[model samples]
Target: MTTSVDHDVSPDSSRRPPTEMVQLKHPGRVIGAVFALLLAFLLFRSFLTNENYEWEVVGEYLFNEQIMLGLGRTLILTAVAMTVGILFGIVLATCRLSENKVISLAAGAYLWFFRGTPLLIQLVFWYNLSALYPHLGISLPFGGPELWGGETNKILDLWFVALLGLSLNESAYMAEIVRGGLLAVPRQQTEAAKALGMSSWLTFRRIVLPQALRVIVPPTGNQVIGMLKHSSLVSVIALPELLYSAQLIYSQSFQTIPLLIVVALWYLLCTTVLSMIQSRIERYYGRGSHPTTPTKKSLRQRLRTRNEEVAK
Candidate 1:
């Protein structure tokens, strides 16, 4: 009787369960999606049919040379200012997080002054800086021969002022973002690095920052897009960015809405590109956060290597 024991009654087979696939359907979700699509369709139809948009003029001036030049200036300003801001922001954040009170206070005061003021006000101030300080100079600590001196207006042109205003303001905000990211790094990780005889700076560079990037990237991206739009404020000082160029044209042509639509479309295109870049960066830095997903950078590097080998 005992010899008739079933082989299928083994522990492994007992633990195995039959596979069943589930497909969830919610009528409320379907209805809500349909309603949203209907609303979007109606809104788009209105835009297409509306005469006020002046689509013909928008098409005509979309690729105008003046607009292209202005867009180039906008791109240059965004790149330069963000580069400067991020660099300065690193220093400021380090100061704020340092052990010394004097350094931290200095960084705090800098942030307070810049962040408290509106960006538009800062732009206006920079544009009119000569009114307050007619002369610009660099002097030694003991007041030796001035290293450099010039009239503020001569040196601080509209372009320079725009860069200064954007960079200074952005540095304040970026410093805060950087500080938050640094603070988010776990104490245990730093302790472990120190145990391995790593210097503070080396540990920070190799361990802390690599970990902090997962937190830092989202806000940094937001700052980038914000800086791009903030560059528009320079138009008030006649720096001739995309919006300003459109204004210059529409002032003569009386096609305000059309030119606005054109630039608006361009801005939308730019932000879309930036958003895509932000996603790629986020994915590259997120490999450890999600174990199952793969990174694009490795695949891209492999493909590039293959292409170069083929060329060779």
Candidate 2:
């Protein structure tokens, strides 16, 4: 006996031609071309101007040992200050989030005082610390030995005071950035970790912080760039950073605009480099979370295909 078998097929199961390809946007190409032309035109016009800016002057200052040294110092100061500031910021954020009233209150007061005051005033305050207090020494809260001793003026004379002031001032803003990042983390994440028997510290380190870093890094990068530029302010106290070095050169040659141009170029270079770094960091942190283009196959289908391949 011959048996007739019935087959069922859905018309929609048939594959259709790939949808018309969407054109990739080239916004950057247009912007870049326009900007490049504008820059070239400006440079050509500057060269033809009667002021006759000496390109040699720019080259000389650019390669000058004093200027280079000052640039190096500025970079170092920025790096050190940002590092310390971020660390202090983490501490402050933790304190602000603490269950203890005293800790939270102290953190709030610190943030308020630093954020309320001007950075320039803070710098001047550090520079003139000796005037405020003649002697500097570590005193115990209860009854311990005075472990440290130094004259305030002598200590302030060193770069230490400037570093301290910059770090402290920056910490206020950094604290806010950190707190925002921490708050951005979902409370359910903490609860889930706790449900899994993870301790608070472990949960924070492994789960919350890693996710919060995505939110924190962007603003933190901005703060770092700001710190680099703000290092110029220390020049008022004879820090001899890039801006001050330029000032010294212009004072001698009286080519104020040219000297200022050199400074501006260096700042542009630094900020540009920093912005590239920020982009890379953001991309790295965005890996899995970024919206991906969906393919025809669902995730389960993809996984089944992989499993089949493994079986083969």
Candidate 3:
């Protein structure tokens, strides 16, 4: 007698779920649509109620040379402040993580003072620095020649006060961001670098910082955008930034709402553009570690492969 072969298959094998047909819902899209509708309705009502709500007036003020110049100044201040803030933040965060008690204490004190107080108060304080100290000067610890030059009243200058206050305030928050990023880096990374005979600086520069950048960049971008808007607060000191310029225009034209709208629109535009840039940067950094698709290929290589497949 000959043995017979049986080909039995499980039922589940033939009844696999269709993942390709699965539908996913996005709540964000719905919420955004609703918010857009509400905003449009409010804008329409404002236009109808205000006989002086001329779109041309808004455009004119927006494009005015003086306003544009003020906008440029605002951008410059934001860039300078953020740059200085992040630099100082790195130092403060590193100090906080240091073994030295003095450095840690100093860093803690800075964060405590800045974060505890309102930014507005800091601005005013900086604007009136001359009142606190009649003659300001910088010198070496052992009392050498002055570092450069200083004038107490000079601090009250709009740009000087804006820069000083913004940089100092931003540094506190940046310290937090840097600390978080540093903490996100696994302890094992530092240990491994040390095991390989790397110096602390080398380990941080080569291994830790590169990884931490992914975590830090998004928040840093947010801070940059916030700084841009916060620069408007310097208008209190008569800085001719976008908002101040708008105020001057409205003061003359008596178009408060319209001028205010122009300022809001500019802020919206700047924030939107910055957000787009942030998204691109985040996407770039996230590409390799993306959960949806994990691959070791370089971005250019991946693009090339896709192009080849499409051509085929």
Candidate 4:
């Protein structure tokens, strides 16, 4: 009995056969990628080689004084409008979140009307507002004595109207964004702040806002970029912002496609810069909050471990 050694339990019992790995083939995916690259190359070649694009004229007027001026105005309007929108949006979001029914209702009504209406329609209406009210002034509740008055056309000039429409419309959208960010802050965080003897405003300003900014900043940046594009709508009212400026140049020289291309290129450049800034801001606010990404070696190790367990 002591001499009965089992041949099946050899010294190499722990050793396992090597697993052969075969990568999955995806010929369809490779073919599709090649076809797409070829199509893109052709399109890019056409942009350079096509005589109809008038690349020379585009180069000539890309930085024309008038075009630069229009771009400047467009940037200014975007800044001013977004500033007003952010400020007013914060107020609206706060009011909507308020305990008072009347304040919340009023904020809701404002959001409803502005968000429901088309921005273009709002811009046109504001530009032609002198039609509805010839003069604007503050007066008594019962239409008693007019304390002050001014011609509507003079008071609501093109710049003023453009700002009014853009800011108001943008505020409505921003309110929702701000409100959503505020809501993302956990209820427990606020409670903890309250326990630490922080006032409501202080809690929001300190604990809540810093955290909520991580959520708010990304969308707010997108809104800033959108405001740049939306500012072009003011061209309808002859505000002579970027797009309108291009239209003016083209209308005279009959270089419609080239001038339009210049405008598109400028817009693309601006949006690209804004996108980079947005990415930086998001990373700043998101520091220490997001989990670190796994390195390739770590990922491969994890997969190997999983496969070994599955084989066992």
Candidate 5:
């Protein structure tokens, strides 16, 4: 006698009863969606009808060479600043979570001072730091050659000063963001990792950070967009970033509003792209936290099992 293995063959889908309709309607969602559409339409109409916006001047300088150069500089500044800020933010966050009082307090105090001051003031301070110290250099404790610097302008140009200011200021905010992410993870997961013989650094790198990113990413995306626009503050230091470029053109041509409009449009474009990127990243990480819906094959398997049970 031969033993038979059961085959999970599904009944024909066409023979299955029709699915019941879902009657759980959300009236609030429907009303809110409609209101949002109407508001968007009204704003679009207003923008199209507003003749005082100087459409011609905006069109003329929107892609001017100087404006383009400034846009490039703004992108570069944002990338470098955010990178430095995030790297240092991780360090600060880790230090803050450490057991040592001196290290933790030092990190906390750094965050307090940086976050307490206005970023504009920070930019100005860095720009004028040469006045405070006159020169920047590093020498051996026993006295050796000055490692760097002849003049402040030569050593720290407006570019470096703006980058330094933006980075230091951003670190304060990012540190808090990162710290919150670290704290959000369950302590038991870390304990298990340590029990498994993982080193502190390895556990943080391999496990903690990936889990923390789900919490950290949304705020970090907002920070990235904010950093892009905040680079405009560099215009105050006469750095030829996008805003300064627009200002330069408007001053000579005497068409201020249109140039500003151009600047605003560029900012909107950059932020829109960043927002799209943020959405994709959120969806990718979100998958791990929530159960995924069954696919067609899984549904078939379930149906076959159900049919077998009915036959039995």
Candidate 6:
């Protein structure tokens, strides 16, 4: 017997309701988010209701003339000291990497001494350097005739001493940072540059340095922020900086906590701005590498994505 097959199928045979999609429930994540929000709300409420915080005082001195001047001085010190540190650090890093044992040893010695000693002592020592050297000038080695001379205290003023201490201290840290960045570049890149008829200096300046900056800029930015805070140590030498300015105000006003709050707020603001700039620099240098960088998404966008995925 011949079997009969249906030539046409009914639409109902092919059609069925779309599968209901349910998003996976993460109860733990929801709990964690709720806990974090509660904690943040409590902290914020405390800040608003706390009587001793003296938000008014913070607002009053936030843009006070003395505070503004101190802020400017702090910024200047950080800029100049970091500039000197980066330049000297590059030299030190090069010396540390030199083939000559003596050159490398010298760099190592410099790093050891600076990195070993306390920065506070260094600042104090420089401030009191006139005690050791009665006069200051350029002279030949081993007490050779002085080409130029000046009184030590006059030449080594507070500003000069502060800068010297900060720059020297920063250079030691930056040296290691620079050396690490340089080492991050592969050996083959240098070899390839040489094969392409590039001079050693040209290869470093054009090929290695740019690539190394991806490693360098981040730590350097940290060093910059550290330098900004570390600058408060200069207050011991009576150099007027941000923290010192706050101290001066509180000393007279006797509103110690409020003045400190002012300083803390200013620091937070400055550091926040610096952090944004650092992120921008990082993104700029991080282009073209594998494992693409993730972009930030807002909460609303994320929720929308979650809903769409669940619908799918």
Clashing pairs in 6: none
Taken over the whole model, the C-alpha lDDT of each candidate is: 0.91, 0.87, 0.87, 0.94, 0.91, 0.91
Give the poorly placed runs of model 4, Cα more than 4 Å off. Answer: 1-28, 140-145, 300-312
Clashing pairs in 4: none
Using all chains and alpha carbons, the TM-scores for the candidates as numbered come to 0.84, 0.79, 0.79, 0.90, 0.80, 0.84
Candidate 2: stretches off by over 4 Å: 1-44, 47-52, 139-147, 292-312
Candidate 2 whole-model C-alpha lDDT, 0 to 1:
0.87
Question: For residue 158, what is the lDDT in candidate 2?
Answer: 45
lDDT per residue as tens, model 1, 1-312: 367756666454544343333457799999999999999999999999999987988999999999999899988999999999999999999999999999999999999999999999999999889999999999887868889999999999988999999999999999999999999999999999999999999998999999899888989998998888889989899999999999999999999999999888888899899999999999988877976644566656676676565544
- The alpha-carbon RMSD values of the candidates against the true structure, listed in the order shown, are 9.0, 7.3, 6.8, 3.4, 8.3, 4.9
Residues 1-312 of candidate 6 have per-residue lDDT tens digits of 999998798665665443434467899999999999999999999999999898898899889999999999998998999999999999999999999999999999999999999999999999988899988889999979999989998998889988999999999999999999999999999999999999999999999999999999999999999998899899999998998998999999999988888888888888899999999999889888548544444544666677666555
- Candidate 3 lDDT score at position 17: 44
| Model 4 Cα lDDT, one tens digit per residue, 1-312 | 479766787555665654544567999999999999999999999998999999999999999999999999999999999999999999999999999999999999999999999999999999888899999999988869998889999999999999999999999999999999999999999999999999999998999999999989999999999999999999999998999999998889999999999999999999999999999999999999989999867767777776786566
- The sequence of per-residue lDDT tens digits that candidate 2 reaches over residues 37-142 is 9999998897767465776678778778888888999999999999999999999998999999999999999999999998889888888888879999897879
Question: What count of clashes does model 1 give?
Answer: 0
Best by TM-score: 4
Query: Taking the tens digit of each residue's C-alpha lDDT, what string does model 3 give over 1-312?
Result: 999887697665665342222246999999999999999999989887877877778877778888888889989999999999999999889998989999899999999999999899999998887887877878888878887666778645777788999999999999999999999999998999999999999999999988888999999999999999999999988889999998898898898987888888888999999999999998887667656654545555666666565544
Count of backbone collisions within predicted model 5: 0
Per-residue error at 26 for model 6, in Å? 3.7
Q: Which of the two, 1 or 3, has more lDDT?
A: 1
**Model 1: worst 10 consecutive residues (lDDT sum):** 13-22
Poorly placed runs, candidate 3 (over 4 Å): 1-52, 138-151, 293-312
